[model samples]
Every structure is written in C-alpha cells, then in structure tokens.
Target: MTYDPTFDQTRLDQLADQCLADNTGTGKVIFLSDDEDNRLELTSWRFEDEEAKARLMKSDFKLYLLELLDTLLVYRAQHKQPNASRGVVSVCKNQMTVQWVSRAEAERLRDL
Candidate 1:
C-alpha cells in the first residue's frame, strides 16, 4: 500500500471532528502508533483544562484511530522508511498535523 497524503489528511480531519463532538471543549488530540506494534496510544486534553488530560482514553474514537493506524502502518511498511518507526497524528483547534518519527521520539511522546 502506498501513502496517500490526501487520505491521511481527510482521516485526521474526521478524527478531529469526532474528538470535538465527543467533548466540545477538546483543545488537542494526539494519536501515536509504532509500526512494529499493534498498539495505538492517544493523548488528549481540554482547552479549558490542560491538567485534565486523557479525557478521551475510553472514547469510541479509539476504534476509528486503530483502523486508521493499521492503514498507516501498511503504507509505512510499503514505503520502508527505517527512521520512520512511528506515526504521530496531532489535532489542535481542529487543525491536524501528521508526522513520522523514530522509535525513541515515539516513546518520548508516549511518555508525555
């Protein structure tokens, strides 16, 4: 499978919409995944309450994110980028940024 930037952007937009719908006050949402693993981690916080993070930990958005991550992993594998061991999708104020990073970077973000 090849990477489709447009598709990724569209998916990210949908995810952001879902997050906002789940929590109208959602300020940011982050999705992290390692290409070598099936785990997809999420970090989210409300604009009004940064201290209260992970509000979406148990939200249904995870299922959507998992499917998106699976597709992204397939594309990453086909592209074969050694340094791109992880995929990060971030949404803030309804804007999305998608990136590929190293395992170390992923771990650091996961810890945040």
Candidate 2:
C-alpha cells in the first residue's frame, strides 16, 4: 500500500521566498509514516556558495532558471498545486539539507 498526503504549495513557495531573501536556496522532503517498516536513502548535491552565486549572476543563469521553470510547469500539470491546508511537518534533520534555485520550483515539490 502507498499513501501520499499533499502539502500546501503556498507554504512551500513562502519558505523558498524566505530562503531567497536570505540569499540562499532551499529544498524540502515529506516523510509519510504511519505503521510501516521502511528504510530510505537520499543522495545529495552540493556546490560552493560563492561560486554558485557568481554563476547565477551570469548569462547561463537564464538557461538554468528556464530549465527549473519547465520542470515546475510539468509538476503542476501532473498534480494540481496544493492549497494552504497542510503545514510543514519537519525541518532540516540528520545533517541533510536542500537548496532551491527558485520559489516556484519549491512549490512544485510541495506535494512530493
């Protein structure tokens, strides 16, 4: 059996905005747990903050943003963007972190 509870896209977007306001990128993961035995593995990607910022300020950033936008559009098409019904359930944990290039992209991940 599988269960998935959608999250509030607006909240995710707001979180992303907060991160951007701090000049940072962010990501989120939703853990669905009830009574189950399971294990999860997550792979991470990282970059030097200063270098990433420098790159984002260049012409290439447009292409990068476009790609991200395309992805978000696809996600929205597949599943309607969630409403503000669910609050974020978890914060950064286990020394793991996420960073998003844009708030819209983060909203796309709200239900995942």
Candidate 3:
C-alpha cells in the first residue's frame, strides 16, 4: 500500500474509530490526501495493549478487520467521493495499515 506520512492523526484516527463501529474498537485503516505525484496516502490503526492483541488474534482478526474496514469505507463513500476512503488496508491483532486513495486507486491496487 502507498501512503503519505503527513496525515492528521486526529482525523485519520476518527476514520479509524468510524471503521470499528464501536468506541471500544481499536484497529483500523483510513484514507488520506493524495501526494503531488497523485499517489495514494495511507495510515494504519493499532491497539495499545498486548491483551487486546491476544483477544483479537484469537479470532480471524485479519478477516474481521477487512470486513469492518470495507463496511466503514462504503458507508463513508456514500457521502464522499474522490478521496472516498478507498485503498489497501491490513490488520492484525497488533497493527492495521490502510492506503488512502480514490476509487480508481483501489481499482489499480486490485489489478496488481
């Protein structure tokens, strides 16, 4: 996934919380602004505790993260386009990373 390191943590993290559907939710991925070269920017979500990882990993955390991220993205996309929260997002019990891009950016990623 491609990304920029300059994203606003507050907003990106808001998207992360939005990704989780629950305030207690931890891991997430969200879109950010594009670079001057037009590449998609990215960010990853993470939990703060080892116990949290242990609990989340007990199940298919990756699958759950993907499902949750997709749900959040589609939900947001309905209201926003272009930088419509599309891109590559990954999660483990420990970390989640998402590339921020347009719908076309996600499409290009799929083609890869």
Q: Against the true structure, whose TM-score is highest?
A: 1
Best by lDDT: 1
Cα error, residue 38 of model 1, in Å, equals 7.2
Give the whole-model CA lDDT for all candidates, comma-separated. 0.56, 0.32, 0.46
lDDT of model 3 at position 66: 48
lDDT of 1 by residue, 1-102 (tens): 555557667777877676645453334333454425534444333244443234544666656766776666656566665543465665454456677767
The pairs that clash in candidate 2 are: 26-99, 26-100
Error of 3 at 90 (Å): 4.2
Models, CA RMSD each: 4.1, 14.4, 10.7
Candidate 3 or 1, higher lDDT: 1
Judged by whole-model lDDT over C-alpha atoms, candidate 2 comes out at 0.32
| Candidates by lDDT, descending order | 1, 3, 2
**Prediction 3 TM-score vs. true:** 0.36
Q: Model 2 segments beyond 4 Å from truth?
A: 1-58, 82-112
Off by over 4 Å in 3: 1-59, 90-93
What TM-scores do the predictions have? 0.60, 0.25, 0.36
